[model samples]
Target: MHLYGCPMTRSTRVAWVLEEAGLDYHYTVIDLKSGEGFKPPFINLNPSGKVPALVDGDLILTESAAIGIYIADKVPAAGLIPAVGTSERALHDQWCFFASSELEQPLWLMAKHTFAFPPDQRCPAVLPSAEWEFKRQLKVLAQGLGDKTFILGEQFTVADVLLSHILTWATRGLKMDLGDEKLEAYRQRTQARPALAKAREREAHEAALKAQAQ
Candidate 1:
C-alpha cells in the first residue's frame, strides 16, 4: 500500500487511520507548492489533482473520507468502523457525509477565498458569510455529540476522525470558534490520540526529507 499526501491537508485523516490500524504503507509527499499535483505522475493517480490518494494493489482510491473508510473496513479487527447494515454504520455514514458536505464546506470556501484563489479572484466580503455558516454547523455537531465520548457513544470510529479533523482545522487552522465547549473538548480528546501524533510526525519527517533532497 502507498499513499500520496501533503502536510496539513486532508491526507492526515487517511494517515491517522492507517496508523491506528497498524497497517504498513509507503508515504509519498506531493509537493503542492511546486505544482507537482498537476504534473504527469501524480495527475495520473488522481485527475482531480488532490492529495490523500491511496493505491493498494489494483485499487486506487481518492477522497480522504472514502480512503479512510476503505482502510477501516480492510482491518475489521481495529474496529475503526461499525459493521455494515447496522444502525451504527448508518450513523457513521451520516456524520462522515455531514463533515464533508456541511461542516467542512464553509472551511473550504474560506480557504479558497483566503489563499487558494489568486489575488484578483479572492473576495474578502465572502469571509463573514463563511464564518457564519461554520458556526451554524457547529451547533448541529454539538447537539449530535451531546454527552457521548465518541460519535457512536464509546467506540472510536472513523466518523470521529473525520469530524475531529474538521474541528481541528476550524479551530487551529482557520482560528474560527467551535461555538460549543463540548465540541472543543471533543476535538482535544480526539486529536490527542497517539495514532494522530504519529501520523503527523511521519508526514513532517517525510516533508523535511523531501526538502533536504531538493
Candidate 2:
C-alpha cells in the first residue's frame, strides 16, 4: 500500500489511519508547492487533484473520508469501526456526515479567506463569520460527545479518527474558542493519541528529506 501526501496537508488522515490499523505503508511525497499534485499524473490517481490519495494494489482511492472508512473496514481486527447494522455503526455514519458537512465546510471557507486566496482576492470580512459558524457547529459536536471517551462511548472508532483530526486543525486554524469545556478536552485527547504522534514524526522525517534535497 502507498499513500501520497505532503506535510501539514490532508494526507494526515491516511497517515493516522495507517498507524491505527498497524499497517506499514509506503509514503510518497507529492510536492504541492511545485504543483506536482495537480499535474496529470497525480490527477489521474485522484481526479480531484487532492492530497491523501491511497493506493492498495489495484484499489486506488481518493477523498480522506472514503480512505479512512476503507482502511477501517479492511482491518476489522483493529476495531476502528463497529459491526455492520449495529447502532454504533449507524452513529459513525451520522457523525461522519456531521463532521464533513457541518464542521469541515466552514473551515474550508476560513482557509480560503486566510491563506488559499491572495490578499486582494481574499475576503477577510467573511472570515469572522465563518469562525462563528464553525464555533456553533462545534458546540453541537461537544454535546454529542457527552461523557464518552470517544465518539461512540469508550471505544475509538474510525469516525473519531476523521472528526478529531478535522477538529484539531479547525481549532488551530479557526482559533476555535470551544467555549464548551467538553469539546476542548476531547480535542486535547485526540491530539495526544499515539497514532497522531507517530504520524507527526513521519511527517517531520519526510519534511527533512524534502528540505535536504532543496
- How high is the CA lDDT of each candidate model? 0.95, 0.84
Model 2 / residue 143 / CA error / Å: 1.3
- C-alpha positional error of residue 190 in candidate 1 after TM-score superposition, expressed in Å: 0.3
Please state the error at residue 163 of candidate 2 in Å: 1.9
Candidate 1 residue-wise lDDT, 124-159, digit = tens = 999999999989989899899999999889999899
lDDT at position 201, candidate 2:
83
Q: Estimate each model's TM-score.
A: 0.98, 0.93
Model 2 Cα shift for residue 15 (angstroms): 0.6
lDDT of 2 by residue, 99-142 (tens): 87898888999898888877898988997788889888887888
